[model samples]
Target: MDFHALQQRLRRFANERDWQPYQTPKNLAMAMTVEAAELLEIFQWLTPEQSLNLSDDQRRHLGEELSDVLLYLVQIADHGGVDLDAAVERKLAMNAIKHPPKKS
Candidate 1:
């Protein structure tokens, strides 16, 4: 996935709507959190097994919620001047050091 392109698309989207002012990192983060809560709501009442076996409609809805979370996250990262690819790499490296794989 070309995140730079996606970021640019999002920028164009907001710019066209004159929404860049409201797209500050703090606001976007808050919106992302709200979307995250909506994503969580999808499985709020389901058993673990049931959550894994969503119906087609449920899966579609889940995707929409996930997309919302991701777009807001991208916007937030862009406003903060963070490269998500590098950030993910750094975080994964930290996780590897924090929790090495067990020898089987």
Candidate 2:
């Protein structure tokens, strides 16, 4: 998928909701954390097998919560004027520098 296009689509979604006012960078950051916590709640007390066996309905709910988190994260990154792709590339470059190929 084209991440930039996806970002623009998310922006349009927020615009349709008139939610941009509440979606300041700081607020989006907080909302992302809150939604992430909600996603985690789904797995709070289940055994590994039970969690893994989540029904379609349960999975759909979890997917909604995860989407909420991702929406907020993407908005926050956009609001902060951060180029997420570039940031990820820079981090990977730093990791490469730190963890070079081992000698034979």
Candidate 3:
């Protein structure tokens, strides 16, 4: 799946509904953070084993919440006129430089 294309489609969907006005860069960023916090709530204080045992219903709910977070993050980047893929790549490049491979 082309994430860029998907993001574009989602943007168009929102535009058609006149939702872009509410999705200013700052507001979208805040929404992303809120959704992330909601996603985190599911795992708070839960051991790996306990979390893994979550029922299908719980898993589905978590997945939806996680997707919401990602969508808002994409929207935030889009609203800010940033290419998320390139931004992430640039950050990863910096991280790679910061944590270079160890010599044998």
lDDT of 1: 0.94
Instruction: Give TM per candidate.
Output: 0.96, 0.76, 0.82
Estimate, for each residue in 57-100, the C-alpha lDDT of model 3 and write its tens digit: 88998999989988887777777888888898999999999999
List ranges where model 2 is wrong by over 4 Å.
Answer: 92-104
| Winning candidate number (TM-score) | 1
The candidate 1 region of ten consecutive residues with least summed lDDT is: 71-80
The C-alpha RMSD in Å for every predicted model, in order, reads 0.8, 3.0, 2.1
Candidate 3: which pairs clash? none
- Candidate 2 residue lDDT tens string, 9-31: 98898899998789788888888
- Measured by lDDT, the strongest candidate is 1
Write candidate 1's Cα lDDT for 1-104 as tens digits: 77889999999999999998898899998999999999999999999999999999999999999999999988888899999999999999999999989985
Backbone clash pairs for candidate 1 read: none
Sort by lDDT, top down from the best: 1, 2, 3
Model 2 whole-model lDDT (C-alpha atoms): 0.87
Of 1 and 3, the candidate ahead on lDDT is 1
